[model samples]
Target: MKNLFPILLMLIIMVNASAHGGKNHEHANIFENLQGNNKAAILMVHFGTTHDDTRALTIDALNKKAQAEFPGVELREAYTARIVIKRLGERGIIKQKPQDVLAQLKKEGYTHILIQPSIIIDGVEMESLQKDVVEVQSQFKEIRIGDPLLYSPEDYEKLIDVLTKNIDSETAYIWVGHGTYDSNTAQYAMLDYMLKARGHTNCFVGTIEGYPSFDDMHQQLKASRLKKVVLVPLMFVAGEHAKNDIAEDWKNDLEKEGYSVEVKMEGLGQNPEVQDLYISHLKFKSAHRKIGIIEKKAIYEVTGEKME
Candidate 1:
């Protein structure tokens, strides 16, 4: 019996070491090893908000997740609208600017860049992001471009899974998307359809600028007698709209209308699953480099390509 105890202890130690080694291996592979100045850079392109604090919070969440998952890769964050607004307001005209951003990246020795957009739905912002990508690609000789995040149908299904964690069919789930004036409105329809397809009947997707606005969902919620609603931003960060417009402003209006309402402000940005989705997308593109470019272009044509 005493002899048996030592052998059991040795076996347990081996098991623990093996498990720890596996985790370390995963971490090492995720970050990748780029010696000297050849490391891959991740550019998280957000539809910049005028509110600095909100934008910081949103970008920080994504960066933190990326840093955690990929311990070594360099990460950069930029806002398209806010950057353009500042440049135009200060300079009196929009400067053709990819050199400044790429210059810094080039100085740092980054050759491959994966641009991830925080855009919820397709729109003019995505088109602008694509332009930035093309401009950057032109600047760097060995640059590899990653598709904008919402460019994938899997993103919608991933969103459904992420939201499902916070809510159930009993509670009304309302996702507030930033709708575009352009034909990218189909992305929201995809969001709505995927949500319903996932068996979330009490769920509805509404946009701030497009159809099924807050008023539309509010009326439906009141009419249906659902007292509790979980409001999630279809955005990267639970910014002004999620924090103020929906939780405080809209809830106050709903209460005045004599409907008992409960609001849960859990933005998709904070969801780890969403972060994992982005990481997986990155890894897939990185692994299958040849087909990645072709597949990405096809997706862009379907999702971001404008209609006549």
Candidate 2:
């Protein structure tokens, strides 16, 4: 696994920037000094959840944090899930797409646009958002995207600190996340390594769609001789995947394996530390606009898991 920031960022930005048109190397840091007529708005992009309760705790909560951090910037929301948007439409509710949201920001005379993704990994959903970004790139005066949460090694270190805060030291934790089909899925394995490196022997990360599956979790726990397992959702929202998949499905399955199971049923956004990181990612771009565009300071984690 290659954890070099420039290489990973090139991949991330190549996919993300491909949508936002070309950027000229004007000032190394475009956001260096701006005062008059240069207004910026934050577009918080998410996968979205139909469950209002989870949306309130996870997505809405995170957006509120963003608003509090950047007082003046207008914070708009966009959901990548068309199904969720469609379902909400059936109920007379309208959710905006990122492209439409960016277009509206442009019309409002917002000069600088910062797109902050609350994604855990750089997966297909993140890629989809990048594609949508292409349409409105020309409309906006200046648009830039902040990196996902897992861009730097420090991110994983902080994640281990936050995610494992409430976990009992003695009890094994099985964190379940929504996995991807691509090589990006190796992120889970890398996360697993980070957790262990932090001396978290009892905590393991698994996914519903990708590698480090429930089966892998089972075997890992058995290897550690751990019979008491706590199931936690690694999702930003504790919606269907958390409630049904981790809390219920995996819990029941693990219980059947003679392992005592407990559920946390909390979203990643609930953790203040986690929210702080997202805010930091946005803030990092304001001071370092040259990053990813020209000079990236973050280094990538070279995972043996085929980053290519």
Candidate 3:
């Protein structure tokens, strides 16, 4: 009976260990099953540009960086600008829209999708992208859109650090963006405010078609009394606006105001730090299925309670 007692105790211990370990093993198996079923891909959406030089420097470089950051995951690009896609098609360069690319992804049996847009602000383009994704949301198992470059306050602060790395006290810097007429244009003004608040007093921000107009920026420049001014494009690509509007129009106007102006023909995408920022956002979204309510609240606060 004594020997039987020892054997029975050993059997109980073995049974307990198996029970506990088997439960954990079963959970691990479930997690692996879910991961295995998810066939994921990233869709990089850019406003796109016809200028090959800027395209190569900005869009192409960003795409290559993203691919390197997430190896073995298929990556594709789409252009949000209909006109840019059409123009590229005319030249034997075919660029698809977000919806078209989404369809292709679905056809390829991709169940999960992460869409990252190379957009400066969450404005009209972002709204349009959201709608396009909504139309085909049922086609995919899951889809998440990463935030724009300047969505959160942290994003703005990080961008400022990237942009003001080479600030010169003697020169005034102006960041020109393609602003929209909607209230979203206020983001540019917010960036301008943040710049000065962070001791970038020599820097100013202006838009082509929105608030803080060229005159507004020029007035600030005149007040600053800085003789030299540098124009930087606050855009994904230094395309037509940076080349012509800023290089010619803003530069000439500043020159007329007795300020020696120089335009930096570089886009936001060309900055390595900016590319990494986008990748970080993608990584974050990949880990978290949806953005937090705090982020949504921030967007609403910036857009005057407008969710879209």
Candidate 4:
């Protein structure tokens, strides 16, 4: 009976230890599943350019960012640039068509897809992408689409912050926007407010198509005594504007005008924070899923709020 008493006590201790360990394990499982069990698929849709280097760089940057943020999620790219995609295939930059890439992603165990468009503003490409997302959602009900980076005013703030990083007070930061004749110029107008808020005295934002012209730029350059200028394309890929127009053609005119202009073209998509725009979208889509929110609204949209 004495020996049996010690054995019974030891058994009770073992049972308690097992119970404690079991509770911890169960708690860990709950924490993991609280987020969700489904694997996320990310599709980075861009208005792709035929410019091989530019397209490659833009897609590569998007992929890199997605890999860094959602290491476990599946990632793919779809281009709206049909001509560019065809040219990329000829140049061997892209091996398969956009449809083929979509099929491959579907085959993977990706239950939820987050579509992120790289369009700068609500242009024709953006409107078309919204339609595509609607069609894709009808086919893949499981895929929940996130808002485009520029869809909301919050996104513009992020863009402003990103641009501010590459600019200094000594240099005038000029952005080249792709504008349309029909639409309201409200998008480009935001730049003036943002720059003013940043205390940038010499910053200007204008479009390639309509209102703001290079002639205007030449006039400003001549008038400015700052003497240092940085010209960056607001375009996703620094395609034709960056290579031919700004760096090459514009240089000849500016040089002849006797203003020492330093031209540097940085693709807005290449900026690291721009990737966070997508990350923010993913977090918004996957809030209930196990992942913790790293940054809450890193870019907040201001609608109906006056920008001083």
Candidate 5:
């Protein structure tokens, strides 16, 4: 028994170390390696929404929250979607692109930049954002990009908690996300599995264009024997996709199949907890001041070439 004490202690220490290493690695000093007179600013990038109502509730609300939390830290926003920007332009509302924003920031003499995207997952949009940042990376002293909402395992658990806080266990719940053709679409499936694993068996996830399609979720709903369903938008804003795809189309299809449907009409960004998660991600990146780039795995998958 005496000989086993040290071995048991060692095993416990190793387990604790592994867990801390994976999740809390960003706890290091954010200003440790930073140098010079740092004129720091934050750039919040969104996919750009055309609807003013949902934009105020989601995107504008989030931006206000960020500005409040970061008090006196100059903050700006950029839209990734050109079509949205163009449409808004026709209305005489100007929205800048990411590259243009970065250029303007540089011209204003900002030395450091921390970019946080309001994206649900690391899909093609994230890849494109990284490429844009990389192009003008030389303009700034240091630039760091934060991870998306569902980047790490901890992120998945956090999101599950946020989404399922007021969940109705008796009625089936389906989260509809704008799924991508890229491999990142797997995140949606993983979210569905994690929801079930965490005891929310009634919860389901499906993408508009990716795997775990509407049919897949419909089949699951049939097997579960639940007649009532709640459709929630997994996207940041309850814009065209949520209003049209989930609210109108999905609801119609499910009702036709003899199931009672209730549309939430709320985007993920509307949730205070969800907004805080994005802020936390920005704080993490701000402290580290590391270069923001696409993950090596994503780069290889997209271009078929490994990043060193």
Candidate 6:
């Protein structure tokens, strides 16, 4: 009876740790080893949006989760979208440019630093961030930039699992993403392929400005024989793209094509699992500041999962 008491106590402790974030403290300790001689800090950069409501649910939630993960780290933020920054400034909400924020961090004497972007793809924003990193390179002792989401095959696996966590296997999910002309836009196609590759045949991906346009999506669905489809934005905020583009424009198009279209007016950032992926990216960078590249199985949370 007394031995059973200790076993029950151990089980309770394991449950609490797993629920809160398994190995969270271990990851935090490893991140601490990334710090150099000087004070350490993080700059979480993102493409700022104008809609404050979705901004709260998506961007705000993501940042807050990052803060929770690094409870003691000095954290800051910057916005890549100058138009949105200017608009917010006009509304009396002040935000800084990514380069300007990087410069200020340098001035503040934070030697060991990490710039973690919340960007989903490796595109224009990443190039922009690289330029900023170069401009500020001489000022800091060690300044590392975390890779954007979807940099590896394991990333796609994690993404598919998280994005489809609440989705029905029977229904088709048409993910609408903001597109780019750069080579990295192939990610959208790979995402679609991963869905089909993993037996999630009901999932499809299309972009606002990339390959597999609306026509492609229509054709894909036309063959599927599924009458009802849900449009979910593969974006950060459920803002203009999700609301007007996916829900309205795509919705109208699909309905006209003789299909029942449903809009799941939520963005990728709204997913707790997705936000954790971003947080894990930051942690992975911190853990591997000396390595400069990711080791596939070590950092990504979904390395060995058997998919549905």
Q: Which of the numbered candidates is closest to the native, going by highest TM-score?
A: 5
Span of 10 residues, lowest total lDDT, candidate 6: 299-308
Candidate 6 per-residue C-alpha lDDT over 268-308 given as tens digits, one digit per residue, 9 for 90 to 100: 88888888888888887676433221322232322332111
lDDT of 2 by residue, 1-308 (tens): 45665677564654444234323211224355556888777899988888888788878988999999878768899988889899988988789888778878888888888889999887787788878877777876777787788867778887888787777777998888899878988999999988998888898989999898878877888888888888888888898889888888898888888988889888887777888988887776654443252232222232222111
lDDT of 6 at 296: 21
Sort the predicted structures by lDDT, highest score first.
5, 3, 6, 2, 4, 1
lDDT of 5 by residue, 111-154 (tens): 87888999999899999999999999888877788889989889
Residue by residue across 1-308, what tens digits does model 4's lDDT show? 87766755544443344344331111122113323455557777777776667766776777677768778766787878777777778877774434555567657645456666676777677667666655555544355445566656677777777777756777777777776665645667676566667776678776677555677655565565766667778777888777777777766666776667777776777776886786676555543211112211111121221111
Query: What lDDT would each prediction earn against the true structure?
Result: 0.62, 0.78, 0.84, 0.62, 0.85, 0.79
**Sequence-dependent TM-score of model 4:** 0.70
Point to the candidate with the largest lDDT. Answer: 5
List ranges where model 2 is wrong by over 4 Å: 1-36, 291-308
Worst 10 residues of 5 by lDDT: 21-30
Give a tens-digit lDDT track for model 3, residues 1-308: 87766755544443344344332111111112336557888999999999999899889998899899788889999999899999999999999999999999999888888889999998999999999999999998778888899988889999999999978999999999999898999999999999999999999999999988999888888889889989999999999898988999889988887888788989999988999999887776665444245644544454334322
Indicate the TM-score of model 5. Answer: 0.85
Candidate 4, residue 237: the lDDT equals 82
Residue 125 Cα positional deviation in candidate 5, in Å, after optimal superposition: 1.0
Q: All candidates: CA RMSD in angstroms?
A: 12.9, 8.6, 11.1, 13.1, 8.5, 10.4
What ranking emerges by TM-score with the best candidate at the front?
5, 3, 2, 6, 4, 1
| Candidate 1 error regions (>4 Å) | 1-39, 48-57, 83-99, 147-149, 166-168, 215-223, 290-308
Which is superior by TM-score, 1 or 6? Answer: 6
- Structure candidate 5, residue pairs in collision: 30-287
